[model samples]
Target: MSDIDFVGLLSFVPAILRVTTPILLAALGVLISDRAGVLNIGVEGMMLSGAFVGVVASAATGSAAAGLIGAIIVGGLLGAVLAGAVHILKADLILSGIALNIAAAAGTTLLLFLMTGDKGMSGSLASQVLPKVTIPVIADIPLLGTLLSGHHILTYVAFLAVPGVGIFLTRTPLGLRLRAVGESPESAAIAGINVVRVQVMALIVSGAFVGTGGAFLSMGYVSWFSQDMSAGRGFIALAAEVMGHGSASGTMFASLLLGAAEAIAVALQGRGLPSELMQTVPYIVPVIALVVYARRRQRLLARA
Candidate 1:
């Protein structure tokens, strides 16, 4: 294409940031839970629940903050359910999480109908959501402003979560305990680390972030909450945790790669590039990353 199209590729930068926000946040959410040795398979459910709760609250009160609070609380509670079933009730985590996610999908949909008396809850301003925050100087800047300050507050939070999670995992005592629990639960238990408590706490934190990320889907990225709007992002976040090896920066990096692929798919869609491949791009990221990294590791081990 021409130089303008080349510049148009740069437009994907903002789109990347916007698209990456939810993934990054959800990835970070899984990072903590995974680090603490808890497999948070219910992230998808938590996010879907968050999206539903956030939109319903915002529609009722017309307040963004209220929606955020509602999402976090509901998300955390959903996470607690996951943690309780596995930790206290000694349930199979994978099965429990999958059940929760299935329940959340149907639960949120049912709630949407009950609240709005409509199936989709569209065509009404009451169901519309979160206010955008535009800083004066930041919004006035050139192209960068739209790419940066023009996004919702959740976008900034997703970016911040990288270092935030890093510090929490490295600099804090709780971080050490979480890691200890993850790396060696027996050792942590011997050391008097309350494994169950730590796992439940981590799940709560993870759910909070996941919920906030879902809120981004309903309130920040778009003004409407649709059925299964989270799509496969919650599972993608779990893959991100595996890909990142439990590091915050690594999680963000994984999220960015996925986000870039997704951005490309979106751009392709606007230009009517085959919808089949458009769907494929987003799904390809973890596969490619995992394969490449595995090969690299094998080579490094062979060299050593």
Candidate 2:
């Protein structure tokens, strides 16, 4: 019994990190946009588009670098379109987001047929997958080595982004301007921050990172594209952003926390539990969080 406990704990460590990456990356994306007072609803769509573009590019070029680059570019463009519709055209942000997600889903499906003659494009895309990188010396170290050095280059980038983003948002002038815009666009505009410009640019960056996150899944981790592969991760990211109260580091921590729950759920499936039941675990956390968050807010408001 003790041996089983040890092995289960061992398995959980890797699972936690692996699950954390996608949510963490997505949370950062949303954090950037929200900090500018624009809610980005197209994260899942952007991620899906990035996944398709990245996989297609990598398969065609036989280079993971090209794939990563392509995903960022495509995602940025999508964000720009979304921003234009919302900030410029005065379209409803939520509606625009939903439209983009629908477009991403259909566009990818069409491209799959045109590119590889497959409906899902899951097959051809999976053919050109990224290889795991093993650091020679670092990999030999104990727990630190495995957690820090065991993942793909993208995983390293995700971790690096945590502190970098935190510093960028807290210590930089740009960060100040972004926050000002989020707090009040009119005030930010008076301060010469160009609220629209800041929101658009920040959301574009958000899309790029989210795209890269999706690319990590398709090109870096699984190397396959599927319908709605993002699986509502965008929504979860938004929740994390709100829960973290607009701080980059705080949101990142929230993302990782939810990610850990997802990892355990996935592991539970492998233990011969009903896969559907295990899968429900990840989905349930967000619902539970929302209820708790609302209740807390109510209490605080009543006290006030």
Candidate 3:
């Protein structure tokens, strides 16, 4: 390719990473819960709530860090609520998750209306944006600088977390117990693992990761939270987790692919394409990827 063409293509890398950050973080969260056999279908709601909480807390305290912490705390509480619904109330897991999503959507809007007297957005609030990080030495490099430095802090955290999650799941004692419970709660119980406790912890951890993603949405991606700003990214994260087949590194790659699709759509919007059609690109890519993954899995099973 020509140098100009190559450079133009490379320009998209940063956008891809920026878009991928929240999806990757949330996908990792989904991976944790799924591994513990308690899929967090309410991850969408948790993310939406987190975004709202982050904005409100940041604006109220004049501290972005406080917003992030508040978001994480709220996400964990939502996860605990989900766990309670399943374990204590004996609610169907899937139904409970769906209910949470519905409640989060309505609840955030209601809270936003009460706070700023606006239900659709947080424009009245003076929320802080999380700062971007510029690696000192890396920032001086040519193409490497663009790819590796000067990203929102959460972007770095999300990427670094891939290996951290991988290690936790594969090398830790708690990881083993969580996996055992996921594989067979009955067997795990017989083996002396407290299935309920393990699942609860997994959901909390999952929600924490998800909350960070939500914080990114409001604090890093934009300085204000909009109604439904999550924009179905949480659902996309679920697809990424499924595409990842329960592996952190795989999920990261899947998130990048989906992020690239969204980035391309954004780019296309400037090229005079219908904005409505372009908006569907991100969602469409996941459907296609999932179909391919399902076919591949079926083929492997047949071969087996």
Candidate 4:
């Protein structure tokens, strides 16, 4: 490719990363929960709640960091509630998750309306956004600088978390127990592992990760939160986790692929193409990828 063409192509890198950050973080969270056999289907709700909480907290405290913390804590509490519904109340896991999602949607909107007298958005709140980070030397480099430097702080955390999550799942003692529980709770229990405790912890940690992703949605790019601001990113993250085949690194790659699809769609807008059609690209990519992966897996299994 020509230099100009290459540079033009490279310009999309930042956008892709920006789009991928929240998905990657939430996908990692899903990975953790899935590894423990709980499979947090309420991730969507947790993310929405987190975004709402982050905005409200940041506005109240005038501190972005405080907002992020509040988001994580609320997310963890939601996870715990899910756990309680399943283990204590004997509710079905899937149904409980669905209820949580429903509740979050209505709760956030109601809370916003009560707080700001507006149900659609939070424009009146003086929320703080998370800062971007610039690597000093890297920022001065040629193409590498543009690719690596000057990203939202959460973007770095999301990428760094790939390796961090991998190590936690593969190298740590708790990781082993978590995976063992996922594989077979009966077998894990036979081995003296506390399956309930492990799964509870997994869901809580999963929610915290998801909450951080929500904070990015509100505080990373926009300084405010809106009704349904999560925009189904949590569901996309679930697809990423499924495509990752239960691996953190794989999940990261899946998130990047989905993010790229969305970024391309955004880039294509106002270029004379149908805006509605372009908006579907991100969702379509995941369905196609999942189908292809499923077919491949089936073929491999048949051959084996």
Candidate 5:
């Protein structure tokens, strides 16, 4: 920690924002599902599926928008399936999620091999990239503009989603019911809310958010999908949600904090540090942050 160069880190704000996009998006998904009383541990699988399908669809159609739509559709479908497994099939949510993640990892690799004869990546495909957005007046504001403007469109969407999610959960009727169901399914059911339906919907929405994050990985952050491209980001997003304690804004901030750590990890590469240790830094920071967050929560609760 003392070895980190503070001045150099300042220049990485944009990189932090860029990397934070997918994490924030995925964390939002986790937040919603958690709030709705359903935990979708298969978010990683959903993200991978979306990434693969998005790249494939965009390559075939020559449209990034189509790729995004494809990711969302696939993600939502997967979410619904997981929901069914937990709610209707009476499967353990954690075990079912683990199974889904394993299946998705293998299935996507197989599909990738079948399509491009390369299990590592879809380098052969010419996929369309999502456009970057530059705020008009904001772009001209010297230093501030440099930091604030010219991000991928999805970055804006991801940040905007923070508030949007908060509003949806706090101000909407469906949100209230979802929370009620999550808090006490029996009570919610007694009050005439279909607990199963709400859980299913929450999972679907969660999947959609994860899917969008996946799409950003393939289309916005990079131009192609690789096997296991999600690379534990789903888990990091989960951590962000846990650290945030299921608040949209808090989750967004947590994701950004992790993103900054990741950016520092990237920047520190090849700078006299052991390559393996530098690689581990990004993952290590989140664990530390989560521990700190947990400690803080415990203290607060003890005081209360």
Candidate 6:
């Protein structure tokens, strides 16, 4: 620990930003659905489906943009399907989401095998990678550019979404009704709001966000899709959402914390520390954050 270069570890800031992008986007999705009273437990499946479909579309069309569009469409459709299952068919949301996740995991693997003759990954596919953006003036700056420029376009989108989602949830009439529905569906319905419609719309929007994050994995984070590449990111995003109390900016902060921990684990590799333990750091941080959040909530409740 004493030998660890603190400044060198600080370089993990860039890595933290990169790793946090997917989680930030996904957590924003979770925040929307949660605020609307529909917790999307199938976010994992939604993300996996987007990743698989994004790679397939990119490889087929030879365009990363097309791949991203395809992912958003698929993700939105899945979101609608999830909502329909809960609202129309009266299925339990949690069970339906878990089913979708199971299906996505197996479905993606089977599709990968059919497409590339390899069930593990789409490495052989000629998928285009999403372009990275170098912020104009920021990129010209010395240290600032090094810290802030050259990230994938989706990373910038994820940060931009923080404000976008915040504004939507706070300033819009629809957002007001959505919150009303979440707080009390019966009251919202009596007040002339269509509870079902609001919940469904929130879920579809959440799906679009989750899909974008999924595409970031296959199209931007890397150039190919792999089996279960989401690697529990959907769950981590959920944890972030909980830690943030469903606020967009708050979720972003929690995601950054977790991302930084993961980045440090990566930076510390092979440095005489236990590699297995290091890999657990990212996961551990979320658990700790949740515990802290719960304690704070308890303290607030006690005071009240």
Residue 137 C-alpha lDDT in model 5: 99
Note the clash tally of each candidate. Answer: 0, 0, 0, 0, 0, 0
Q: Residue 264 error for model 6, in Å?
A: 1.5
Candidate 3 residue 41 Cα shift, in angstroms, is 0.4
Candidate 6 per-residue lDDT, tens place, 1-304, comes to 3435755554566788989998998899999999999998989999998998898899989999999998998889999999999999999999999999999999999888887899876567656999999889998986678688988899999999999999999999998898899999999999999999999999999999999999999988788999999988898899999988778889999889877788788878778899999988888889988898899999999999
Query: In model 3, which regions exceed 4 Å deviation?
Result: none
lDDT, model 5: 0.89
What is the lDDT of every predicted structure here? 0.85, 0.82, 0.94, 0.94, 0.89, 0.90
Residue-by-residue lDDT tens digits, candidate 1, 11-88: 678789888888898889889988888878999999998888888788788888888889999989988999989977
Pairs that collide, model 3: none
Candidate 1: worst-modelled 10 consecutive residues by lDDT: 121-130
Candidate 4 stretches with Cα past 4 Å from truth are none
Cα error, residue 91 of model 2, in Å, equals 0.7
Residue 62's lDDT within candidate 2 is 85
Clashes of 6: 0
Q: Distance from true position, residue 192, model 3, in Å? A: 0.5
Model 2, 191-253: lDDT tens per residue?
A: 888888899999899999888888877876577787677777777877887777777778877
* Residue-pair clash count for candidate 2: 0
Model 6, TM vs. native? 0.95
Local accuracy of candidate 4 as per-residue lDDT tens digits, 55-99: 999999999999999999999999999999998898998899999
Q: Where is model 5 more than 4 Å wrong at Cα?
A: 1-10, 301-304
> What would you estimate as the lDDT of candidate 2?
0.82
Candidates in order, TM-scores: namely 0.91, 0.93, 0.98, 0.98, 0.95, 0.95
